[model samples]
Target chain A: MAARERDGLKAVPYRSAYRRVAWFVVGALLVLGPVVFTPYWLGLLTQVMVFAVLAMSLDILLGYTGLPSLGHAGLFGVAAYAVAVLSTAHHASFWVCVIGGIVAGTLVSAVFGLFVSHVRDVYFLMITLALGMVVWGLSYRWIPVTGGDNGISGIPRLESHAGLPVSGPTPVYYVTLAVLIVCGVLMARLVRSPFGYTLRGIRENEARMKSLGFNTWLHCYVSYVIAGAFASVAGVLWAYYNGFVGPTYVDLTASSEVFLMVTLGGPGTLVGPALGAGAIVLLKNVMSAYTHRWLLILGAVYIVTILGAPQGLWNLRVSSPPRGTRRTRR
Target chain B: MSWWRVALVVVIAGATLVATAQPVSPPIKLGFLAPLSGAYAQNGRDILNGLLLYLDEIGYRAAGRTIELLVEDDEAIPAVGLTKARKLVERDGVHVMAGALLSSTGYALAPYIDSMRIPMVYPVVSADDLTQRKRSKWIVRTGYSGSQPNHAFGEYAYRVLKLRKVATIALDYAFGWESVGGFERTFVADGGAVTQKIWCPVSVHDFAPYLTQVSRDVDAVYALVLGRAALQFMRQYREFGLKDRVLLIGAGTTTDEHVLPFMGDEALGVITALHYSAALDTPANRTFVAAYRARFRKIPSYYAESMYTGAKWLVAATESIHGHVEDRAALVDALRAVKVADLPRGPVELDAYGNPIENVYVRKVERVNGELQNTVIATFPKVSQFWKYNPSDYLKQPLYSR
Candidate 1:
């Protein structure tokens, strides 16, 4: 017991040192990635960052609260459409468009959460799928408003209210990077807070949480809306980046892709989803240039990842226990 | 010193020598975006084959420079299309682009092409706005607009066929809406009434309920359906015995040459109008058809013809400019100025909108040597995209939307 306590004490400084090194490396990459990457790769990295935000939002719902949403794209696409319509039609300022997208996404999610909050498991999945399809139908069939299958195009690049030009690929990538960092920090804080603990408790034992006087449904509802709002942030950036929005963005295929990213990354891990997004987007954009069967390669990677490391690539390492854990337990 | 350092030094020296030795002109890279692996893969293949066939005939050289073609599959999604297009421009550094089979993809790409200042030659996306309301100087469409052939068909149905009452059925989308709109405008102006108009969803598998609503009082029915849907509609129309009761007319793609041979007798006697027909008895068309057949082991469709024409136009423009596409504006001007007196589709000229002004042939599906063919019976010469309507006036009207 004394030897185990000594071993535990020895692990503390080493673990903290490891963490500091990891963070330092991450900071260095974040600062220098744009400089190192070519313009084309920068564009791709920007897309990866945008999708990372989206996958992280999905992770918050499915991984934390165990909601298993299939209509995440509906929120994302609605926000994009809102931004597109306001900016194109009303000529709203950039801040106004961004807020409008977030509000629209939040409101839609609130209403949808009200409807589906009572359902659980497969029923919830089906409802979300149906909701996604309805949004897609609206975008596709409402030709006058949504521009039908052609979608809304020619959205001007984002500019500050003061008319400072924040356009072009480089400026846009930096803007997206800033937003991603802010969202990542906020989400990490949210998932570690007391409210986050309650969510995990509910996920593990809903009845037990209910017995403990927790309003599980309200918690789920709030998480759902929060996830939707985060997705909208990604959508707003995407709309500004692509300068276009179409029904394809809201379709079931897009929602399924986010779910794939969440699962392929370690679910419930903040950075895992971002890594997954990077891997998937890179595999698609980079590998596609060299070969036509990139999808096949992606599929092979997915199968290998699933079979070899079921907890995802992020959790593959075997680690020593942290210092003081054995001492505290004893 | 290490062997690797010596190897790196030799490689740098070799690169410097090659850079200084520049003899031949650099190759002009042309990017081709198409749906190579999705629902529209077959159509994409046909278009690519047509473009490549022309290049092959020229021995892959134009304007004293080797022409390099880069193909990317967009999977028929607009977002994917835009991403691939950007990759081609920013990464591959392609000077020009061609081939967008889906209208949605084409529409999404219009602004990007303008922003990048690269010219694009559209082969088979027939969105009218690309050449009309939202026309861009950077774009030149070698393919027909959605409304072009329908306008001619409307006139022919009213004048030659002597149809006073016509009903229309089409897929409920931009292409369908524009087609019927063009037909309605022309038919109404010619003192003919359209009895009924039916729009079915693009993914609709059953056309029974819609077919039942087609009024028997109409003198003829004009339908605009594409791909497998066209085949399904034709077979169902035959099964319902409506073919014997009323004259059936359609947009050119309803009985498109690509689908006709496979359709057997189901498409017999169906009349339509289009810019190109393989059976167009002319020296240029005969030679094109022969070469296409010899190369691809099949008769060329309008898609193949459109891409072939686009390739020919690109070659002509490149030759005129002595392969100097470095000046984008000059290249665009050169492209606009060149007029083809003889193409597989006959004489073609670009209107102010950069859309083709070419002959529209009114053809019928007939069996020739036990194989189905679109046999041209009437020709509307030198038809513009706007048909007889004044361009300015047409642009004043709101775009056709359902």
Candidate 2:
């Protein structure tokens, strides 16, 4: 009964030109948006770009692995703390700290993923939630080390680039935009790869993939690690951009916000999640400029969006014109 | 357009707007860099509302020019603090930036603003470093320090209440660390023995663990929690039967505006060290309160009072600069000349570090006019965070560079 499909997910229609247009739009934004706007807007745009990276990471697990892990924020927080402590306490170089943060996030997610590989369906979400709480506890209790509730402040900013001090928000925006573009391209390529096809196969029918001599659990485990690694990069970027890291990064809301971005944008699409994240981050900042009841308004919008745009915001925005590689599952 | 063009356009447009927006007749541009969103939004908004009320009351113009406010939300995040600070100074082109409520955010933004040569009149932040150690050429505080209330609490404990044994239970953060450290040093020097210190993490929802660890022999407990934690601790502290056993004096902010009403009976009789007692009987205080009530239809907070002082001071400095704020040194000199003695919180002065050395009051919450208001029992001699004894010595201590 469980094996039967009442309806199958239709494959996404492929469009290379559409992909080019998206890239062009992103490029245009990087240059024109910063110059035409103020430093405040540039800084605000940078934050949107950061959250977009995080949304893309969650898409890996939800879209590729078909495992909707609810606790990705735990990985995000882990990477942030790793970077902050390593750079601030251990005095690690910037590159070393970034790499260290990614590695730490991967390790943490991998350990949890190993146990979670045994659980299926709702159990996966429950186990991930529990694991996320455990990480939060560790950050809180390890006060002497993590700086506890006060958060790790006075974190050094990117003082210079390649030994040259890059002054102004212009340089910082360019750097962040470049990183975001690179990450987007990599994610798109990953989704188009042979490995990606196999993961989709697992998402479609795990039992069938198992019968075909493929260990579906290994696929899920690997996806978690990759997603965790990507999330770590986002976390490290957040640490660098903010110049401070707090335990709130590890909380449920962080994970929930990421989850919202993916689901709200287009959970299974490569670029859709990023668009959703960018939209949310930008709007959240601008929304406060208008009213103090942002949370109330956000709550109302959440209720309205889930009802209206449940299929994803990208779908709503892009009319009937379709995009992405449509792989038919036989 | 190519990607490079997009990036260049954004940078140029933003910079252009900021530079050109500088001079407008009387040239008073007021910008508030408080958290208008996120966790501490309400507090920032409260101060923002209060200051705007004063602005409206004062006709929102000073130095013969209309005042323009550019507000940015710090979101109570330290990381967002400097970015917002930079954006306000560089892009929004705010001549005077004021009112960052979080001490950590103020501490983080102080150096960045100084480097840019924009004098920031910090409102709500009580971190001692913002004035003492982190003192900059372009920064001034119109608010009290984290330890101001503790200065009075020390005197009260010694002279009036006669409490010999005390214990501090504070959140494990900068505000917590500095407040408790300041209070303990003063209280202990006055022959009060601090028993055992308990540090609760900021995210803690329950105080059972901390309450269980409190020593039974302590004569009083100084609880330092703010935001939702304060409400939780108050209810729990009373429920745990600890209120009767020991005096539940706060480290000041725990029983402030946000948590006071929600805390109810548990908050009654509890003492807090605050710069503004909300019930100050002075004429300046009365007028400030009346204006605040008319504008926001609510009582003003210490946070709001500080923001008002900072805003008024910044406006006075703006008049001195005569709309030519681009001259960094001139602007710095203009800021140094700002003196607001008739402030809502009584007399406040800015020393070299730009921190306010003001009166610290010890007030007990009493039922008055069908509401719990801070009843001033004693006010300490005006104390500067550059402490009478230490005098910026503690500021000289190396900042936690790590």
Highest DockQ among the candidates is held by which one?
1
The ten-residue window of minimal lDDT in model 1 chain B covers B257-266
Tell me the lDDT of model 2 at A118: 72
The parts of candidate 1 lying over 4 Å away from their true place are A1-16, A159-162, A165-167, A318-330, B1-22
Maximum-lDDT candidate: 1
| lDDT by residue for model 1 (A1-330), tens | 111212113445776678668878876776787788777888898899999999999988877777788999999999999998988878888788889999998899999889878777788889999998999999999887789989998877764432665556777878888999899887877877888777777776789999999999999989988999999999998898888899889999999988888878766667768888988888988788889898899899999988876655654533432221111110
lDDT of 2 by residue, B1-402 (tens): 999999999999999998889744545666777887766777888888867876877687776677787777778866556666766676667776777887667656764675566767777777766666546676776777777667667767866888888887898777887788777777888888888888876778999999988988988898899888888899999999998888988777888865676668888899888888778899998998888878777777777777777777776776676656556677678777766568778887776666677888888988887787888888876777755666646665743221
What is the C-alpha local distance difference test score of each model?
0.86, 0.75
Q: Give the TM-score of candidate 1.
A: 0.93
| Residue-level lDDT for B17 in candidate 2 | 95
Model 1 per-residue lDDT at A157: 75
TM of each candidate vs. truth: 0.93, 0.84
Q: What is the model-wide C-alpha lDDT for candidate 1?
A: 0.86
Tens-place lDDT per residue, model 2, A1-330, is 101110133434555456556767766767787668777788788788888888988888876677777789899889989988998789888788878989999899889889887776688878888888888878866866786545676556664522346676666677777778778777767766777777877777788999999988888888888888888888888877776777667877677889888877866676668777877776666675577676687777667777886657655644542433223321
Query: Model 1, residue B260: what's the lDDT?
Result: 81
